[model samples]
Target: MKNYDKYTREYFTPPVSSLKWTQKEYITAPPTWCSVDLRDGNQALVVPMNLQEKLEYFQLLLQIGFKEIEVGFPAASETEFAFLRTLIEQDLIPEDVTIQVLTQSREHIIRKTFEALQGVNKAIVHLYNSTSVAQREQVFRKSKAEIIDIAISGAELVKTCAAQTDGNFQFQYSPESFTGTEVEFALEICNRVLDVWQPTAQNKVIINLPATVSLSMPHIYASQIEYMSEHLNYRDHVILSLHPHNDRGTGVADAELGMLAGGQRVEGTLFGNGERTGNVDVITLALNLFSHGVNPHLHLENIPEIMSEYERLTRMKVSKRHPYAGELVFTAFSGSHQDAIAKGMKWREEGNGPHWSVPYLLIDPKDIGREYEGDIIRINSQSGKGGIGYVLEQNFGIDLPGEMREAVGYRVKGVSDRLHKELIPDEIYEIFIEEYVNITAPLELINYCFTHRDDYEATVSVRMGEELKEFTGVGNGRLDAISNALRTNLGMDYTNLVYKEHALEIGSESQAVTYIGITASEGTVYWGCGIDNDVMTSSVKALFSVVNKLHHSTSTQRLVNNR
Candidate 1:
């Protein structure tokens, strides 16, 4: 903060203002994606990927549906040259995909780049040189005209080399650091390079405008792109491309806005991996299109698998919070967020519409190889009754009643808080079983038989601590009759006995589960669950479980009061 005055805005706005890109609402189609992972991304790595890793990463880019990939700056290193040769010699490059190689504006580098493309079926000869004012004044110490000459000479050499080379080639020119360059000067340099190539309809040239340092807001970049798109030479035969970096953490925004400004192609890395803050994340850009109902044309159905392969090959970890591919992107830990997600999922399941409009989720996790259980509703201390209940119903087919879920949620949250860890589905199930299901301590139902008399007569065998006894009572129903018998023989006074039953649909179809809730004299309701092959037996067990819970709660409270 103290040195804030030391830095000033270095980006140059276009002389002519064109904000037409603002009228467009969204990108109706995905741009032509060119991955620079092997080149820009590898150069930034602390330990550059080996030959084998580059090969594997290239294959991965192919699988992700990149039509054009900048393999590397072949002239920069023997390893880069070898990797390009390996792709060509081993016939690893797919017919539909075009491999690109970066080169400086020098003649030898251009010639060496062409040499690396010796037998390639199709390739793009990418030529670049720094054109920003900073580079002109400090780095290259050259005038704008001299910088333009460098790009033109490189374009001429690349053109001559392509004519002599055996491979099919296209020309690409980048005014490196285009964002910091004056827009008028940037356009002039690109057009001069285009003059040397004279690209045709069949072999259109790429004019890449890279925000090499991301010196301004996204709108300024968009305006600069629009100016170039409108004023470029051989406009019909030029492909406007954007290569944005993440120095300002808005690479994705810059790419999106550039596309909206008539830029056709994008050159970026998989997860924004490159020099410094990294390149624009192609994954984020493509998935952003996908979320807006546009087909990104990339096979991203299994993001986890892609992330694993990327981390393994690049030796870089994808952050757990990374968009669409992170481990916790779909997980909800907040109670309110979990509740909304649970309810939204239910609403969607009931045929709400064809659209994915779930609350707290931009897109369905299952659409990208993630599931609801374990991934969506994570059970932490901040979890709510809705999410807990939804998790139970989805994973274990044990749907807690609406009134009972809150009490169960509190108990589960207490356990998780004490343990200081998230509860897995199995752990949550175990907690449910230990705390609420078939609990028998002070009162246990050893046996029960029912007979139909005037109003459902019941004979029940019960155990209380060390004593076992038999009791009989009649009520309108079997569970009521049993409750009446228990209340009379055990001198337990309670009312409003609630019971509900459902057949277990997950592990055992034949087993029936029943839930019971009883209100004590103090207006507190204790809940319990029971599972058995017979519905009547499960109902009786459930009643006993609730009675035991009530007795334990009362005893614990009395002890606390005495203390």
Candidate 2:
């Protein structure tokens, strides 16, 4: 007979081995990608999206193959209700998709929620309220009896309101902050809700006992969930779900432990974009299962499209450090990682990589729309011969001698350190030629001019190698003009060069540096750097610099005598 408080206290603090795992499951594999991005995500935002943006974002979520999406709290705002109504009126929802709205215990709000769902064919009214001691003490400041009363009233209202809808309607209730809630009390209240709704096995009600927050170690959460899993008498009549917040950066771990404890449902947003530290990064979590050979049923190949849509709708930037979908996640900057990935490539060519050289990769980058060739990043201080060699092999299918690779890699690193970024294949070739080929003359750009003004007309001309190369073009910027200059006079084709600039120094007076990553003929990537006080000039120069380097390197190489 464990005291409820004592049992919970113990559950919140447990041993590691009890939660450490070797296997994982992603329900999305069987196609159960639940999107809480708009709901949980909206609440987390300090400046929530406008109603139009919210509607657009909701539609975008469905486009990513999420059959069920948590839209927003209908009971909370008029704007939210309007967003829900917009979805209903437009009939924009897919037949297979279900829209979900959230609410609390107040009878008035629940009735309003019912009004909002009047014409919906399929929907979920997620009823939630805090149930744990932490909520009582810290948030609600209620006694146990008072909290239980709140729970019962809330559950009753949700049932009454949901009955108004004829189509597939679901009632999901969460013992909010359930991670720190006592089992008996939590169970008592949840069981009462079940008794009132009496949801059958086939039409089972969801009892979402979220970790709400990571209260302690993974094992403790596991134990608490396990205890609840074993204690439930009408298990077949309920869907036990878990929603874990990564407050301590272990939301993924806590959720995994809950699944280990028999939880069958998960709730999260893409890229873990939510309040505070965000929810468990669903991409990382799902792919984690994929790495271990569990089919999480999710089409991971759709990640880039999802990322692009998310970035557009949310107007939020995804950090490069973000896992899976981030620009840098699959890239390896360390020499050792590059060496291993390169060897893996060779073994792949030999048709034996799955067993041979696979240390750096847990999953193939190509499976997620990432180029395996880009894995060996030539960043400063950590790059080596392996990175340079791999880049040349990938871009040109030509191998450099090991000794030249070392020398070339060194020169590239020196420039990369000065430039502070990953050098591309053409940049590597330029640096290689500059170091190996004898260049008695350095062609300095004495003067350059590029102007983009008066409704997007642009032009550029530069004095280079004692000759004037002038080119005019119509584009959105001066960089485009300079690229035109290179294409017209330098015998360099105008490859699509992406100019992404960043300020290297702090404050308003800081100089902006432009890093141009160019994709040229034969799919080769070239990098160039430029610095200036003005953004457009820096970007233009960076674009031209790479072309200049490429032309000079090739010409200089041809002039050398092999004999």
Q: Measure candidate 2: CA RMSD.
A: 15.8
lDDT of 2 by residue, 119-153 (tens): 88888778878887767988889998898788788
What C-alpha root-mean-square deviation, in Å, does candidate 1 show against the real structure?
13.3
Candidate 2 C-alpha error for residue 291, in Å: 1.5
Error of 2 at 369 (Å): 0.8
Residue 360 of model 1 has an lDDT of 81
Candidate 2's displacement at residue 37, Å, is 0.5
Instruction: Tell me the lDDT of candidate 2.
Output: 0.70
Which candidate number would show the highest TM-score if scored against the true structure? 1
Give per-model TM-scores.
0.68, 0.64
* After superposition, candidate 1 runs with Cα above 4 Å error: 375-563
